[model samples]
Target: MPHLNGVTVHPDCRHFRGDIPCRPNKEYGYQCQDCPVYAPTQQRILIIKLGAIGDVIRTTPLLRRLRQEYPNARITWLTLTPAILPQSGGWIDEVLKLELTSVLHLQQREFDLLFNLDKDKEACALLGSIRAHQKFGYQLHPQYGVAWPVGELANHKYLTGVFDELSQQNQKPYVQEIFELCGYEFQHEEYVFDTHDDKGYDWSQLPQGRPRIGLNTGCGDRWTTRLWSDEKWITLINQLQQAGYAPVLLGGEAEAERNQRLHAATGAAYLGTFPLPQFINLMHQMDGIVTQVTMAMHISIALRKPTILMNNIFNPYEFDLYGRGQIVQPDKQCVCFYRGSCKLGPTSCMEDLSAEKVFEAVRVSVPLA
Candidate 1:
């Protein structure tokens, strides 16, 4: 992960001194009350989380809650156009795509409240421009505004305690607190992307109603650790086909080589290099998702699709559970959890997980064929 640089704090900076009426109040950390950007009951709110698909997935539940709290409020999610695309819903009236070109122009909107989800220095600096009445996010480290600074939860007892600080009450239900802080109420059911169409793939080429299974063979750069070897994936898909399940290869151009290799090995269904929205729709068509630990896994969870996540170093406890998948770990416990790459040669943890084991796990977790 990239550490925060001095770019977070410019030399000619506007510091949040308590003396300035517009300065953020420190009593509630950056949850300012007297600041010119401190209006809690505004009719309009702006939410910011500009990158990382997983982070975007996690931040979405907060949107539902924000809607529940203020039904009449016009809520907008301001996110980088490429990194995320929020769905139109009861909670969000509009998704304002935050292109780099218009970031400075945000000052004109005069938003009621702004929640900075990504805490990057670039985002912090940009917040200086939004004419919001309230600004809520992490307190800048004495050095880098809010660049991953140790926050109010530095002395936290449990992992959940960290999220508690940003919320209204820690003891409340998890989803409830998440909504309350985002200023909305939430429905407990997971979110699912509508996937009714055949997507843009050459679906007409394949037989109709084939018992298809989806395979996500690659994770984005951040989650390369969870990626299984091409050899192992090919082996597993072939085994599934022998048992009568028609396996379908799925991925973006990023995983085109891996998908081709697997398809060659199995002579199975393949949806290669389609547009993202169409690819996602195709994924939804499959019986279930077999993937590495990535945003697709989270998407599968939200869709309530049975998913098996092949993990090399990820802990099952750390994530919301996926019903039938096995988590592969090294015989020797891993030292890195949230940071650093697996330095061990060949990544013994995942490489050791045999095709038979993965196949059996998937079979039991998902109805065979």
Candidate 2:
């Protein structure tokens, strides 16, 4: 064993770790001073986007722009759902879960730039506490104790979030708004999703020779107003089957029972629920996706799957399908805009969104062989 000197360590190297040997040394036995692959950290960027998983997936597009702007930056993303974020070998050098340990670590570290995209109180408060030379997006207002826009760029998003009427009138998609928040122009940068292709998930059970269409049946529990009737899903499934496409029921544990019933009723393929990575792999098999404005919709967009997005309560313009999908809404406008439950007793505008319209969109999106 040889004695190591403080001068021998390259602390600014992107791969440098004080507590353990870096990857270059571990694999090739190269000391930090002689490491051929050593890349110095140009900038340290911290992004706080504690999420609803869908937002986390959509926020991935920002990573591309960030990489382009700061090629050698060591980007650290602090999020509630770390699992949903891109893993190693991606733009993000570190994915820290929003917990006490991560909070403490972040407090001690300094960043060249900090972006707190989320308006949540905790997220804003964290942004306030962090030591960053420059900050963008929202921050906790010291006087108001509420999240407020840090700069003029963030004002548009902030106003839209606070005022429903403004949101309704806004035509800018989510990706553009986030890009503007960071003072960058939106160039239709694609999402950086970790498809877990290396996992080698066997999806042979799925029917072949026909275009596989994924029908994500759940809109999540928070927004029950977005839920479509079983009759509509069944109708769409039957229509897809008749139109020479394979309709595959997709959902998580919350939708397991409903998906099972849909499968039994229409005899469409239902492969069952899976963990996030596995579920994403299953969705990867689809030629197209039909879903409400839920996590599945974001995932579908990330996967570049042609999608038919059903909307009722939220602004259709809020979503950017990357031109791969179309938004289908009810004939009658929803009275429950931005609502969790239908205001109209025992009926919803989602009922007016005909299954035929969705089927037609699917046919156009993923046409027959």
Candidate 3:
């Protein structure tokens, strides 16, 4: 009913922004009244999954199902790591970082559907505060002052999160669990990632005529229990090189010194770590990947590269590699389940998982050229 200049403004349009000029208008100088690319927002959906970068990346599979279910929905994702999320032409219409400003803005809006995947108190609290016609996943219980599942569908995932034994017994992959929580069945939906191919990054330093294997050396600082020894990595590098595959070292700034040492020791291709987007592009160049249950593993899976996931602490069933990778565990069962530090003091099950075992898994899993 209201006019901006000569054209009537449609607030329900997906591209309509009250504060700034809409994208369609800015790009094509088109008014809201007769805009050709006017996509009306049907439902407003909020997804609250503020967690680790890897967790954020893995949660992307739900977008596929959401788009199919709500084709005209204006989806907004709230996360701690916004950069990890796919930007343009992706499922999410808006990506908001978890902060006071974002919280204030979110509190002002009402959604048709709200899904708070994280069980954290802050996340649950936000879920309780947000106005939505239908709510799913966890929410903060006002009386108990704790996070509780919204419905029976979320009970399984909630129980697993609380109890280690139940989590270990869970045969369902993460995608299936999330789908069930949202009242849908899992259908092998793939991760939606922006590979950043248009960046034009030159990766010619890696030798040609050989399959490039990315060796993600770090398991992040939080989970030191998942870390493999440097000696074992060196051995794996040598094994890869001998097998006619180019071994490339991949890690974040935390693993820079170790990666440098490994590179110097084994003459492996080590293009020092770049930013998140550039690092993703670097992983894209790899034919296969060998990594602990870290961000690299998620990135490799999203890229659809054949991967050898060296795991011990977490449940193997939790990860869905989309039939592109194999999970290799240690011969000795890990005493510390879901722990940051090894309960067995000096001895670790990771030592039991030898370089030869990993190399063999790589050879079998990765289709070498």
Return whichever of 1 and 3 wins on lDDT.
Answer: 3
Arranged by lDDT with the best first, the candidates are 3, 2, 1
| TM-score for each of the candidates | 0.71, 0.97, 0.97
Backbone clashes, candidate 3: 0
lDDT of 1 at 56: 66
Ten-residue stretch with the least lDDT total in model 1: 6-15
lDDT of each: 0.59, 0.91, 0.91
TM-score of predicted model 3?
0.97
Q: Per-residue lDDT tens digits of candidate 2, residues 250-311?
A: 99999999999999999899998899999998999999999999999999999999989999
Q: Tens-digit lDDT track for model 1 on 1-369?
A: 112352222111132222343234344344332234433333678777776665566566675556656665666677765324545334565566667655755667777777765556676665666777776653345565555422333222123434533332334443343344443444563542344353344566443554566788888776455667888888888888887777788788788987887777778777567765666667667776787777777666656677776665554454444344555453456544433366665464567667887777667766753
Off by over 4 Å in 1: 1-42, 82-87, 146-189, 192-202, 206-210, 321-332, 338-340
TM-score of 2: 0.97
Global local distance difference test of model 1:
0.59
